[model samples]
Target: MKNWIIIFIVSALVGFGAGYFIFQDKEEADGTNQTTTQEKESKQENVVKEESKDSNAPKTATTSDGGIFSEKGCISCHSVSALNIQGGATGPDLSKAYDNVEGKHGKPIKEFLKVPTSAVMSGVIEGNPLTDEEIEKIVEALKKAAEK
Candidate 1:
């Protein structure tokens, strides 16, 4: 009877130990999965919020000619102080670009707008060439801003 009791106690301890380790491993796995799921949810929410905010924002710059500079993503690089517009400062302030293109570059603004041969502009316009109408409107807008 004594030997039987000892064997039963040993079996119970082994079972309990195995169950504890197995439960702990399962719990850890579930915790990792929950953390991963929460991270993914947070990222998705941020994306949705950004999209919503962008959709409600203005699509064009506040230029005289109603040029859609932001539509072409120019606002990501340049800013026009005359228009009271603030944008990324990666490129130059374009409030005086019209004057520079004509006076310094010694080329018609329209010609520069069409080809954009300058080092800084060529790369920006290469992949996304503007339409003649867009160039004309934007040039007019820039000219108006330069006058201010």
Candidate 2:
């Protein structure tokens, strides 16, 4: 009985250590996500500052339409750092989409803006088309990321 008790305790300790390590790694991953978002925000601030310094530079809209996108349930398939992604769906990571658009395709923002969410990228959790404005805001966020 004593030997069994000892074995059980040892097993429990090993399980606990494994859980601790896994959780610690998860916390680190979350931290990295936060850091990435912060870096993006910082880069955006720099761009705004530069644009402001150049009076002739075209004005970039800072108004966040992220909420509207979230409210419309875009988060069901996409994630925006400062927006709703609680029920985020199984879509291709939007993180790299911008580069595929501008860098690879060499498409203008307006042309890139014409993506039909249903057809351009597959593996979406479900079919739900976003409004033109919502697409613009999401595209804007993507463009900002591309610039970085």
Candidate 3:
């Protein structure tokens, strides 16, 4: 009877020690996972904030020959930071239009002004093709904006 009692106590101690170690390991792994998740979330939030700051930055100097753009109602659908103008969001930002127009189109911006290719732009300028002088002035303004 005495020997049996001693053996039962020893088994119970072994079981308790094994359970303690297993549970401790699981708790440590859970803490590590939680920390990793928090770090990732923090990095994502920082990236979003940086992007937001860039988009919302204040406009700088106005475009040199912005009058032609304004006269042609280009200001109605385009935003040019160099021109310090914030138009509607309907059209792509003209601040970087020179790069796309001159590089991708492989033609002078004046030609595009005479006959815009995009459907949305075609509708906007359907009956209002810019004159030679107007196109020149607008091109000059866009080039200036792009340089900055």
Best by lDDT: 1
List clashing residue pairs in candidate 3.
none
Per-residue alpha-carbon lDDT of candidate 1 for residues 1-148, written as tens digits (9 for 90 to 100): 9999999999999999999999876664455534563564466445434644785643335444333565565666787777655556898888888888778666888888777767767766774688988887788778877999
For candidate 2, report its TM-score. Answer: 0.35
lDDT by candidate, in order shown: 0.69, 0.53, 0.67
Candidate ranking (lDDT, best to worst): 1, 3, 2
lDDT tens digits, residue span 1-148, model 3: 9999999999999999999999876664455434563564466445434544676754322344475655566655677876676555787789888778857565667777777766666655664567788778888888888998
The 10-residue segment with the lowest total lDDT in model 3: 56-65
Model 2 segments more than 4 A misplaced: 1-65, 81-89, 102-131
> Which regions in candidate 1 have their CA more than 4 angstroms from the true location?
1-67
10 residues in a row with least lDDT, candidate 1: 58-67
Candidate 3 local lDDT, residue 5: 100
Error of 2 at 19 (Å): 42
